[model samples]
Target chain A: MSEAKFSVSFAGPLVTLQDAGRPGNMRYGVAASGPMDRLAFDAAHAALGNPTGGTAIEVSLGGVILNCTSGAVTVAVTGGDFVVEHGGQKRASWTVLAVSEGERLTIRAGRAGSWAYLAFAGDIVAQPWLGSHATHAPAGFGGGAVLSGHSIEVKNTALREDRLGDIPQPEFIPDGPIRVVTGPQDRYFAEGAVERFLSSPYAVTDAFDRMGMRLDGPELDLKAALSIPSEPIARGSVQVSGDGVPTVLLSDHQTTGGYPKIATVISCDIDRLAQLRAKDKLRFAAVSPEQAVATCRSYLETKQAYLDQISIARGTLEQRLMRENLISGWSEGDERAAT
Target chain B: MPGHAPKFDAIADHAVLVSFADTISDEAHAQVIALDQALAKNPPQGFVEAVPALVNLLVSFDVMATDHAVVIMHLKALLDALEVNSVSGHEREVLVCYDTELGPDLDAVASATGLSVDAVINAHLSGDYRVLMYGFAPGYAYLSGVANEIQVPRKTKPVRDVPAGSVIIAGPQCLVTTLTMPTGWSIIGQSPTRILTGDPDAPFLFDVGDKVTFSRINRATYERMKDGTHHV
Candidate 1:
């Protein structure tokens, strides 16, 4: 068996390994958590010829440097347009590369987005808690956070790892209105508050992370019978805290909440919300269930199109951009030039 | 042009909330329970979970597998089979400890109700509270029908984390916490019984309709139960 291992040469703020996520455990009060950017995570895996569901390194607002041992291993790097280096040489973001054993790979500060993914040819190595490899940043992870000097391990898989050239990045990562569905508690807010919520624009705040995105904008006046029982919160549900600052819960949100949920961001659009950086403005548009389903279908089709491709070339944006392909504009390249 | 009123309003893409009125009354609650039983006896394809709240019944399903029309058909059929007041709910008996150390809010409850500490405990013990449903925490059940003397309004401010197995009363209801929870209820006691554990090996202690009662225990009993030396 060919031996492979990785150790962090430089440690950044917050980095962890994540798979698709642990589903079917929400009944146990545990949240289904995985990569914040599913499209990027999938791209990295597709490039490495690794299974889509294996755990991979999720490098976020912070970054890291790593080195592998033994034979040359194929690695796929995707997510934010960060500066990446293989063996002291700078390379384009997104795409797979074969690094010789004992060579160091460096990831610098993120320029376009918040997080990135690094998928090795082999399965991501981590303790699977609750049937997932994703790290729960809020609830100090069961497996330790990625640290310097820790030896990485991977599972034995038979798929051949393939290297791909960069694909051309696309234009217009959409910043169009983030659509939401009027909720069970829409009446809790005043008529004007509801209108303001629909009419006004909210900007994603800097104090954002995997846990939640704090949106800053109008003070929505919500005055109802002083009591509302806390209910189970869903991902992308817009919950207004006491201060009226609307925060959107993400992958790391708590199982339940008491705050009035004025609206729920459809599952497909949530990926768009996740890609937004702090200070990026977004409009809220209410869409019917039909529209939500249509959006979801479009995204699924796009993902299938990319996965169907067998061979990829290096240094073009399409190789990375096409692979990610989240609809409603959640991609990093689109976010940068979005008007 | 819009079609004539198609019966119930759409609550969401894949779920519906049939409402008889805006508030909870005996008739409305009975109606809710009837719908719950009918749905349980025969659920629609892709039916996920059904929760009956004070005045409404919330039905959820996966839209990917089941469309809105089929779910609506199931809900309408459930209402049709619904015989009012035909359903019966089972009760849970939760064993609890009532003492100064375990019952931190005992004195406060006694003072608010103008009853002695022991009197408050006795009244609480005598009342048979029905388990409304499980929520607020993983297996934590919200129960209705606490004695009037034990009932108290929740605090203006909520605490961060109430311990696991906390037996507390808030308003007309009391709750047996199944997980470590943040609550505003008056703590009257704790239970030697653990109703919930996330691990896969253990059997689930309480269901939706099990009776729960309180039993006072000393430090020795608490230790025995804590260390697994005590068996149910």
Candidate 2:
């Protein structure tokens, strides 16, 4: 409790806090409300040695200016590229930073991507309702948008860390076809619609958000897309609504829907899509559920290997690069040197 | 009684969808629930998620490292091994106050079915209802098995916002609203009995096979219950 501090500023579209999410409450009509980018959320916390269940500032594409009041803590920024500043100096993301009391930390928008995570070293300051601090926007559980001038209490846990490894750049990420399986109401559409759906190269439209990802591609021709009563849909579920637009359900999606879901994106690929901003081109490949499971395990294994390499590189260059921005040779700037 | 195997195919790279039938039916629903129960009891490898729908179960497993073709085969084997004949005998009875004031649509419901309000109440109260499933809202149960006399069509234009605890009836079924939601169901009476609560130990008071019942209560009881001075 003594380690917890209040927020001094919220510069962007910030929310209370979130983690992997609130699950098992779906039976009670309560959606599992948690963070948008589950993979990044876990990765950030893992890098900080924080529990996966710990609370973190889930910032939207719009960045924020967060200032803590007390206790020395370790913090990490993951998900989307965001410019972070510590004590008015340019800081870094995807890596951990140890901060003292009363320091101002700012995270501003950078290149591409939608969401970002600011994970504290300890438990967040808030009463847990239904076992999570992550906001369920629709349910109105955790309050929305961390606006400027609003202050939130954050408790610091015992964190002992001098420096974390190097934060990897964007391209270091892997790219692959998003896998899918046919949906329950999939038969309601015309014969070829499902085929076209599996083969078509759909672009993630600008209409993407935490609630749903609207895809743009071939217009599905359904002989009879009867309106059925709204039923349950899970995250990563690709539901083709009445208007023929395919929307991939995400974290903030409703508990149930009436649309005809032709396919469901694989769980492993969802994080990849979550990192993708609007207009990102991606193709869908249909595979069996067993195949999806197999592929995801391999993909996770591949991702783990890359992360391991990144970790090794960071450890080897800990003092020279990651810890201190040390530049040995090159006595002058490139422009000046060329002159 | 046709003993048949449900068709299953990959819905995504990581999820395999097991369909009991082309359309939702009692037999299909039974098969799905039984298979879902079996899977929950013995889940697959890299098995990250499972969601049961009306006539199908969407199972997501780790596909990259594991073999999906094999996993689907295993699921088909498990399905072949299950018995789909029984309508699960489990029951959960929920208490609700049914009256005109609490149920605004009681008059319309009775009128639509050409029955008296008391008859409507008797029909609703005397029968056994199956808990169709939990969705729409937290702990809200979409129960089936209403008598022919209590059936009514949903409002052409649903309400913009229906408060929680609203007992609704539409199309030969009854649905309890656990949260404030917009619905097309005919609003009858409101109940103080919370079908949905946030206790993990008592996660859900009603499972899919449970039954729900309604009891009549006066305005005094409603007010007292609303004020936390009474319980159903």
Candidate 3:
């Protein structure tokens, strides 16, 4: 086996290797433990003009530092906001940068988002369990979280021709309350509970993790006792605990739950909900399943546009832009004037 | 059987849950099992897996590969044309050691049912149980057909760490756990079955519709089976 590409010097409190995750493992009581921000994870590769598919390091709350041990590797950082520095020089995230051997890259937490994805050109070397490399940290399965002093290997791949591209960032933060759809057990809630849920604003609490997020808000009262005859649950389920607090299940939620769920967050907005930090205000808006599906399609289309816009060609932006004859007066011979 | 009008609703962008009944019962489980088996036989395009629970079936699909409406339409047709009477559920014999050492709550369970310890054990052994669903944890099977005479309510205070393979019953269900999770159920016996192997290709040794018959065994037998030197 070839030597590891880089050595981790500081992996924050919680970091894990993740891919799209194993979806069909629910029968064995496994949750789909993919990235908290799916679009951000995809953007990590899209920004780099790399095809999506590989285990990326998901850094939570950020503060990860890595030293390039051997071999130069191209890296892209996306999702949330983070201050990224390579060789003591500040570098913008959501764009590709090369980390040369003996160099260092440090990532510090930003004020905006909760999760960030650092994807490399080659797939991360790890054993796949249940057909997934997505780390299920709670269960201690799959590629567990990154720790300090650990070395990670990146499989060899042909170097890409593209050096830089305009990072396709989300143009605008989506406005309005997070959208949700009434669930199979919506009827179990009291008459006005669903309305109360929609009208009231909930605060994201510190009691949050990959498994779920507990939101403190108006108590969504049930028509009867809260327990159901244990049924299957999916990510984004708004399960009300006996304490009357509503918890939105995330990527690593349990396969099944007995708590009555009033509504499920629409799929397109799950990433938005995941980015909400503690003390952030949250509201809910109800939509039909069909509307939710349509919204998902639109979001997917926007992502595709990002991939299509990637202009793959060459050296740094300065080098390529100067070398190309896109401008009438700009040419390689006019490099002095361009400078 | 015709009284059941299964309801299907979207749970997420890629998953829909089909409920056979609002309450748990043999009929509801039957419909759940039938739908699970039928879907397995002719799994629709973009189908991932159908997780059958007490009264509902959670079906997941690839939203990119297929539309949500298309899946709902196919599920509706499957329910309408489904023949649930011929489900071939497998039968497996489970050996248990109901001694005081392993079954710490045996006395409590026996007294709660107002029966001698041996009588409680015998009644439990005589149960004609079927795997109702797997939930709560990996390879943890919720079973139906707990003997009515031995049925007991969950403990007022749950035990912190019930060992894996601890055979327990709560309300009307028996659960064989592959995890050492906490529970409020009364522990009446201990089994020597490795329900969860953690291997993806061979994850669980049981399924939703498997018939289970518990047979009483001694500590020595339990130890041997637990060690994988003998099969019960």
Candidate 4:
């Protein structure tokens, strides 16, 4: 095990250690507390060519800063538009960097995303609870949240052979209605409740956390009882409480709940929903389960395409930029000359 | 009689929820346990996990390998082959202290139930209970079969910071708190025994369908057990 270490100079309140999460343990009431933005987490790992299931520091909107204290390791940052400064140099969100001893890396909340991930080239050296390093702070299961002054260690650090280069910013579908699969409990709602839910725009409330996101919208009237017999809930389940408010359960949600869930946000859309900050207004669009599955497959394909496109540059940044066409009506030479 | 035929609904693209009954009942609980055990014994391809609740079983699968229809098909076959009668769970004994200091709601529950404080405790002790499911928080087991006489509705407002090891009851359910959190249930007693040991291999003391019975202990014994000086 290589003895690479990074000491936390600053960390956001919600920053915590996470991997793919501890699945199959929900029956014990433990929610699989993985990354809020799973696609970004995977991207960070893919950028470093590290195997999946390794730990990543899940940074919330508050941001975090770290300093390399010992050894050397390669790190990748992905997710939300976060300003990343590595060793006094500004780096893009989806970029990989190598850090040596005494070098400082700072990440602050940027204009776009709410969650980001910092993944190391090697395995993080935190003790795993219940076969996972994902922290469920409410349950106090994993290792709890990462804090300032904490030294994070990575083992088996190996540098990539090819020098890293510029990465194209990933494109997402323009913000539209978030797709959802209506019902496991849509029957509980009044006849027009689902239609109203789909039609009305809901503002993301400040009462958001890893557990669930509360939305302020038209009250969904239930035809059935307010609370059903408690049942197992999925990550994207939109459970409506007695007050007729809908709250979308997230990664850290309890395994089961008593509220009647009207619909479940499709897996592919969960990452998108997780990125929305408080007061962001969004609508829900109903899709069939088959369509949801198909969308998920296509989403995975897109992510794979992004991973495949990541390659080390053979030339300098300017040369690499000049090699590709940058303008719609002009040649690369003209764009370079203008720059 | 056997429970109603299970109804499968797609909760997510990767998850299917099989409802055994419309409301909570022994038959539904049995069916849930039966299905849970059957799936554990022989999980199908792309099987992720099966979470059993009061009257339903939620089966999540890997979307890359299987979708809701495939999972529902697999679960239907598993259900057809399941031996419901074969489902049986282990029994566990919990030691609890029912002192007024530890159980702040004891007197209130007693008055509400039109019974003496000692009678309320006795009723709680006399009841037969089975682990219904785990939910709300880690290792928080919801046990069924709180005595009808002592059963009461959940508090309209939740009391925050209810400590771990609290023996609480609401409606027909009883739960031994595993974490300090807000609870709407009435705290009837406090258990010294650790329900959540924090061990990865076996973090929880009780499992769904486990038969749990409580034994009364004095304040001294509770203190001793809490301090690790008492073995029983």
True contacts kept of each: 0.06, 0.51, 0.57, 0.80
Candidate 1, residues A228-323, lDDT tens digits: the string is 654546667788877777998887776555677787776656665787788989889887767765655555555545543422433245544665
* TM-score, first chain, each model: 0.85, 0.83, 0.89, 0.89
lDDT score for residue A49 of model 4: 75
Model 4 residue B199 CA deviation in Å: 3.7
By DockQ, the best candidate is 4
DockQ for every model comes to 0.19, 0.47, 0.51, 0.57
Q: Is the docking of candidate 1 incorrect, acceptable, medium or high quality?
A: incorrect
Compare the candidates by lDDT and give the number of the best one.
Answer: 4
lDDT of 2 by residue, A1-339 (tens): 447565657655435477567765553456676777776777676666565567887887667876667677777888777777886668556767766778888776777667888887777666565666767665556434466887766565655443354455334244767777676667678888988887788888878766788989988865563856455577788888767878888886765656777878877778778777778888887776657666666656655543443333233344545444655422332222122
Q: Judge candidate 3 at residue A47 and give its lDDT.
A: 64
The number of clashing residue pairs in model 1 is 27
lDDT of 4 by residue, B1-232 (tens): 2657789888767899999877777888899999999899988889989999999999998888988888888888888888889988999999999999999999999999999999999999998999999999888899988999999999999999998889999988899887789998999999987777755567778889999999999999998888872211
Recovered native contacts in candidate 3, as a fraction? 0.57
TM-score sort, best first:
4, 3, 2, 1
The regions of model 4 sitting more than 4 angstroms off are A159-165, A172-175, A308-339, B229-232
Task: Please state the CAPRI-style docking class of candidate 2.
Answer: acceptable
Task: Provide the TM-score for each candidate, comma-separated.
Answer: 0.77, 0.83, 0.88, 0.91
Reference-based lDDT, each prediction: 0.67, 0.68, 0.79, 0.85
